[model samples]
Target: MNLSPAERRAGITVAIFCIAAAALAFGLTLPLLGLLMERDGWSRSAIGLSSAMAPLAILMVSQFMPRLVARFGAKRVILIAALSDAVLLILLKITDDYYLWLPIRFLMGIAISALFVTSESWINEVTENHNRGRVMAIYNIMLSAGFASGPLILVVVGIEGWAPFAAGAIVMMLASLPMIFAKVADPPFEGTASFSVWRYFLVAPTLAGAMLLFAIVENGSTSLLAVYGVRNGLPEGEAVTLISAVVFGGMVMALPVGWLADRMDRIRLLVMLAFMTTAMAILIPWTIADPVWRLVVLFAWGAAASSIYTVAMALQGERFKGADLVTANAAFGTIYGIGSLAGPLVIGGAMDYDDPHGFAWTIIIICAGFLVFTVIRQSMKRG
Candidate 1:
């Protein structure tokens, strides 16, 4: 555990770049897949189903990730993930059939999940407690900024031909090259006893709940925001930018939230974030047609909602380390995948409503569910 200052900086740098790369692939792929399918006459339901495959893969694969990392090392896992991610992006162009997309998307999910688990575990390993909040905040910002940049790239490439797919594959490969040169220490898995994921859940149910809720809200929002915007009469270009607006909020606002996390009560901050996010979701329906106001609300929505994950993960790093940290993050990825699996379906089903604002309502309901859980969790802790 004794890392010199130079090693620490290098490790931190590698982890950040790895995470940013993984995140960029996710940001680029998710919307592009949905939009392309829609353009080819796929139903909202079918498109939503296709999107769910990735999360399903994560939920199934994440349980074994800790062991895989132990056996293979995080750096190796990351390299494989990046390489596989590139291959998967290229594979998407081989077919236009939704059924064919299901398995491809599932493989895509596994690649991204591996990168997610390895990168996060690596980052948590290198970061110290004294500045964990700020570190994670920076991590979250980079991740969000990567996510925001995807739509902007999509704007240039357009969702038409092989160009977007090639771009995605190329960037993923480029992300792997930097890590090939850095020597990241292997995780402490040799003497560590394998812990049940449920044990981690029991130790930190509130944080676990936060991860699940964040996944549901985050995926649901990013996936459908453009569709919702278009349904509400915004141009396709404007609708797509709404996602970037939200991500931009997360990119800029996460730092302040992280600074506050270091200084304030984290549980209380989480509650406040949930409350603010819910309020923003409710306002989306009202602001749907007002482009300027909608952008403003989406920005704030992104800031609050994304900070929940940032702050919660900082809390995890504060409390857990080594094998336990791996288990905790694996648990998080599994739960996040579960929520991600459901988010689009729930939102897509809600969009079936005659009201164009149903997408916002779906988000509100999910946020309310999280808010209620946090309140009850707080009450129980006090009792």
Candidate 2:
């Protein structure tokens, strides 16, 4: 798509705003809620269940996004979603009832899902094919940066009272303002919204697999890695830092990973990264005793694992356009939601059953599965 430079800039701005807002809200809410619930004596299982509702909402809401956009336009959908999210964050702060929080989180998921789909579809629509990888890499970097910044914000504002909630609402409201003023035109929705999960699978099974596995690993690790570290004997502060190391790895490695995708066959690169990630996961059990060494492993692991999603997204743009692109992105979100929904349960179960090493083993198993599947998939294609 040959977009005017002005439109391209506006699209990038909007995309950045959407991702940053989502990441900030996510970063603040997850830890804040968990901490709040823990203080209130809620069980870990209960907290996890409350967290799961959002992804479940995303899974349900994503399928209808194409239709929503078709009827209302991407700009309106995104603006409404962001504003609604800001409102929900404030509501979550006021509500002390656990049952009330669950439904509110579910609604937040729906709103955020709309923002995610529209933002990604918009970015794909505006970017030139040749520059897609790097542009997406930058997007991912901003995303990681936003997530990484959230904890810092929490520390500054303190997570105890209404401060963090107010900050999150303000950030989301700011995110919405750009949608109203950006000159970027929404991608014209053509025909009816086609949101078949199986159809996207048929179009690109490898992309589908990448989306699912990446979400599984990413969500699973983010939710449990610190717990795993603590179980394995690391100090609480150090264990938490492990997650930061991983996020740091993702942010630092973005450009190089994107450069490789732009220059090489993305499938082969994905296979290579999968192997590297698997190797790193296997090393974690051995390295867990040494904080520095374990952080190194996580750093490498984050880079390789996170790159899989980056490349998969770039490939989506390479293979599809127009309405197909919109549908495919919705499919990506749906697949990701499914993975996110299941990842924590699976990994947390394994951790409970096996204790310290279970987390590493679960991740290793998932990474190894991806590596083996990709190799076999490619070999069959060559035949």
Candidate 3:
């Protein structure tokens, strides 16, 4: 942990690049698989089940991540995971069988989860408290940018044949290059006897809750926003573009939010963000009718909501260290997986029951619920 400033920067940069590359593969594959399955005459149910495998893998694999990192080291595990991802992407392209894809997706999920858990812990280990916020903010920005770029690459390569899969494999392989050459030490992990990732939930309930809520809202909105747009009378193309607006908003606002996290009370900042998210959710119904205003509202809303994860991560680093921090991040990933699985089900059902407005209403309820929980938690702490 006694890294020089230059070494710390290099370490953080390498970790960020690894995750960003993973994110790029993630963003590409999630949509690519769905489109491919749909084209192959798979039922919606089958496609949904195939998609669920990855998050389910995250839930199953997260508990073991800390130990893996402890045993193999972060850098080695990351390189292995990235290589596994590339191989899996190629496998996905080689086989067109739905049964085969289920396991491939599941294994891909395991590799992807490793990349996130290890890289996040790596970032936290190298970062000092004073600059953790800014560094994590940059981390989040690159993550969003990388994820958003995946679809653009898909557009260029097209989803047919091996082109799309090949693009993803190439990126995954390329993502490992920086780590291979970087002169940085892996974060040290001394495995603990009583180390329980679940226990960290009690240790940092707010951080856990923030990650869960963010995952639900983010996944729910991303999966359904275009559907919501179409139901609300927008053209299909423009409806799809709404997601870009949200991503753009997140990318634009990450740094400023990071600056605030460094200067102010992060818990309070989280509360304010929840409030801003709630306000934006409430405004969506009104704004969806106007093209310009819809983008404006979503932009601000995306900025606030996405910053919740950035600030929560900064808080996690502020509060924990070493093996404990890795476990905490593993817990974060587990909670995120649960929320991702739940979000679409809950939000999609709401939309089914009430059309487009259900989309916004569901988000409003979740954000408001988080806001209330945060206030009560902070009050009890102060008392």
Clashing pairs for model 1 are none
TM-score for model 1? Answer: 0.89
Query: Which stretches in model 3 have alpha-carbon errors above 4 Å?
Result: 191-195
Best prediction by lDDT: 3
lDDT for model 1: 0.84
Cα displacement (Å) at residue 348, model 2: 1.8
Q: Could you give candidate 1's per-residue lDDT for residues 1-383 as a string of tens digits?
A: 67876777788788888778777878889889988887889897788688778889999888778888888888888899999989988888987677888999899888888888878888878887767778899999888777767766788998888988888898899889878976766555445735667676778888988898789878887778888999998999999889888878888888899899888888899999999999998899998789699999999998998999999999888877777778788889899988887887788778986457778888888888889989998999999
lDDT of 3 by residue, 24-137 (tens): 989999999999889989899999999999999998899889888888999999999999999999999888789999999999999989999999999988899987889989
Go through the candidates in order and give the clash count of each.
0, 0, 0
Per-candidate Cα lDDT values, in order, are 0.84, 0.86, 0.90
Q: Which prediction has more favorable TM-score, 1 or 3?
A: 3
Model 2, TM vs. native: 0.95
lDDT of 2 by residue, 1-383 (tens): 56688878778878777878788887788888888899999998899899888899989888788878878988889889998999999999888779899999999999988988888888877887777888888989988888778777888898877899999999998888877776677777456535464588777888898888889988988888999989988889988888888878888898899988889888888899889989999998999898689889999999988888888889888887777778888999899899998998899889889987888899899889888988999999999
Residue pairs with clashing backbones, model 2 = none
lDDT-based ranking:
3, 2, 1
